[model samples]
Target: MTKFDEQYRDLVFRAIVDGERVVDRTGVGTRKLFGETMRFNLQEEFPAPTLKKLFFESAKKEMFWIYQDQSNDVRLLREKYGVKVWDEWEQKDGTIGHAYGYIIEKHKQIDKLIQGLKENPHGRRHIISLWDIEELPYMSLQPCAFQTIWSVNRGKLNCQLVQRSGDLGLGVPFNTAQYAILVHMVAQCAGLEVGELLHTITDAHVYDNHVEPLKEMLFRPIMRDVKPQLHITNRTQNFYDFLPNDIRLLGYDSHPQIKLEVAV
Candidate 1:
């Protein structure tokens, strides 16, 4: 297994055996760990989890919604791409406030970040943030993978994401697959080779109800011999030009899907 897979498994196993139990927002209780980090070298292979199948289609749609569409409309995702994970977070007015894509749209974070990559590759200001303090109360949920900081070195693009919280069973894998796809897309558009993706989580936890499903994943053999490959069919240099059909996961081998109830 890749270190990405190994560390993910290790973290899950760690939570089962070593994490401290605490009641959380969902009231499901969680066996949680404080802080951890995992590195995935994009040059090596695509860092997709093989112990369990990833919903790459939905992940891609969600990522596209967050980055390209710059939207807070989960209804469109549900009707168009069958991505309903964010339905619970959608308010009655059909918006999640100035969180995530809403903030990106308002601030033009991705556009400016990509522009910086092309104009000033060495600039340290190439960052996109979704956590807006002013909009926190208006949002249904605070951002998790809140910020993305990009750096270009030697014609290769690297990215780091700081997530405030991670749900080990339900949210982690989707975030992993989606963000990895994003780095590849952005790198391709920016005409840089893929470098590495560093993911850091402040609070990583497995909910009580999710523990058993995670255990089943642990028992399965992870496709460790080789990692999957990502493909971008579009050669469009413009980051905003990417369509859902543009991204594809090739030769992604994995175990059967494991179902887990979402805490919220």
Candidate 2:
């Protein structure tokens, strides 16, 4: 019934009835589509998926791993956040080099983005790119949601997230929430209210192994009408000073967690 659930269900339904069968990097082939878009207005809702029990803590922690810690080390994620989602992509040296955090840290885009949002809100160049062409070979996995472009309209921050690939059952839900939160964080730092979040995925797909669970998720009813709220108590303008404790999710009443295997 909420925007998050509607968009999510629509995508799942698309994969079910219209998606084409195809081979992918993981031997677990997928029902694929070329492009799709979903939009969420921060003014209306925070856009947390209300239909399924999303790991809100893990989503926030992963965002912290990407932006706060600026780390590619999966071990640190496990140690700090109790999340092992990146363990498969991590190597012996404990890195997924130049993947997500590496790009932000390397270019210092986060700093520039906030500065640009303040100095030049409509610059048309406030962007962060995660896909590093030269460093691709060194990375254990290529960036999925590779780019994020930001803008300000009517003194409110807006974001357009472009993801090159998305796994419907697992990745998209978390990515959507994390990036929406990213928009909020940036807005708070830049002294602006939040606006719309535009998410565009180029290769959206559902893995073969996750079909059954995906179907089950589609059938489950959303438990409540109230959407989750993201509360950022950090008063500092400095983005790096934001500890995970600064952000919290409130009133996230939803259905049970849906177990679906990640395709490696």
User: Which model scores highest in lDDT?
Assistant: 2
Candidate 2 on 113-162: residue-level lDDT in tens?
99989898889999899877888888888899999999888998999999
Flag regions of model 1 displaced more than 4 Å.
Answer: none
* Superposed model 2: Cα runs more than 4 Å off: none
Q: What is the C-alpha lDDT of each candidate?
A: 0.86, 0.87
Q: Pairing residues by index, what is the TM-score of model 2?
A: 0.97
The weakest ten consecutive residues by lDDT in model 1 span: 221-230
TM-score versus the correct structure, for each prediction: 0.96, 0.97
Cα deviation of 216, candidate 2, in Å: 1.2
lDDT at residue 199 of model 1 (Cα atoms) = 85
